[model samples]
Target: MDIQQQLINAGQYLKANQLAWGTSGNLSARLDDHHALITASGTYMANLKEDDFVTFNLQTGTYEGTRKASKETPFHTGIYRVRQDAKAILHSSPFYTTLFACSSETIISELFIETMYYLEDIAYVDYYHPGTQELGDAIAEKANEANIIMMKNHGVVVFDDSISEALMRIETLEMACRMILKAKECGIKLNLIPQEVVTSFLEDSKYKPRKKKGENFQR
Candidate 1:
């Protein structure tokens, strides 16, 4: 794939979807096992140009080109270090997803097949100052078993084998959060899928890509 165009397209999608507002998010893609193409710090995700990204050595922590890398570069590299399956990483602060992230909710219940399949394990990390080594360490540790991570009082971070898979997981979690809020507003009790059904889905090899060992918690 043309990685530069791919990163540009991902940025545009995040902007168009309002996943990153007020220059609050960042995106990156693996250029090779050793380096990544990342958005520059404070650049608007919606309006990006080829020069807006920088190539950074994930191993040495040095960057090439005149543009500076995003402050969250450490976390991006950290995730790539551990996850051989991760080809792309997106960090965005979406409205509904952040709501659950800041709340007491540790997990969104299994209410849909897509949520169960694409976002099977959602990990929550305690709030740390963004762009700091502390936060990067926390994210790297939690991401060991999570494709989607809820940053406490912050946003969500997702890394997947492909950008589409990562973005889809983000969308799935956002929709699930919206559904939970709507149900509460209506005073309607939720009808979650049974544990047996969820377990069956998890154990099935066909859907094994989504399943990760974790617990379920309601908002």
Candidate 2:
């Protein structure tokens, strides 16, 4: 399937996975050198389809099949503006993350290896009005430095080079958030991975792709 169709499927999957509730999340992908296909404003994610996706000019943030576009369009625009590597962005207000936002908790990847891959730490950006330049600037300032950013009293924004990657980051962040909550609930300390393990894992991982190069290319 084409990217538009894949994007639409991801929209459905977002709702199916309970990552978004009601009218609260936005998604977009780089359509080309200059445009993206994004979800429209106020559309129920549960009922989304490819037709619900709108083509937008990245330079102008103009949506062709407008349903007013997402209220958080600037946030997505901000991501692309800052990170040339970011091809898609997934922004969602999740339950645990919202709770963390309420308590002003900074996200730390304590228990999960998945989150460690995407977010060494998920930074919290100060509150800004949705869809405004303030919101854009706040996220833009930190997005390049962190893959996952949780907005103050708002939601979580994950930036990546593909829709799949963004979605996976969101899921991993949510899992970390939930685990944090569960630990609080049970009155047990979160078991953080040892630094040595984390360092070893990352070091070994970095060389995997290149390890095949010596034999495969034979230059």
Q: What TM-score against the true fold does each predicted structure earn? A: 0.91, 0.88
Model 2: clashing residue pairs?
none
What tens-digit string does per-residue lDDT give for candidate 2 at 1-219?
788777777778888888888878888888777777788887777777766777778788777864667878887887776677778888888788778877855566646667566656466788888889899888887775677788888888887777887788888877778887887889988778887876676567672221111111222
Whole-model lDDT values for every prediction: 0.83, 0.75
Q: Which ten residues in a row have the lowest lDDT in candidate 2?
A: 209-218
Residue 93, model 2, lDDT: 86
lDDT of 2 at 192: 81
At residue 67, what lDDT does model 1 achieve?
Answer: 86
lDDT of 1 by residue, 117-175 (tens): 87677778899999999898898887677878889999999988888878887888888
Residue pairs with colliding backbones in model 1 are: none
- Which candidate wins on lDDT? 1
Please report the TM-score between candidate 1 and the true structure. 0.91
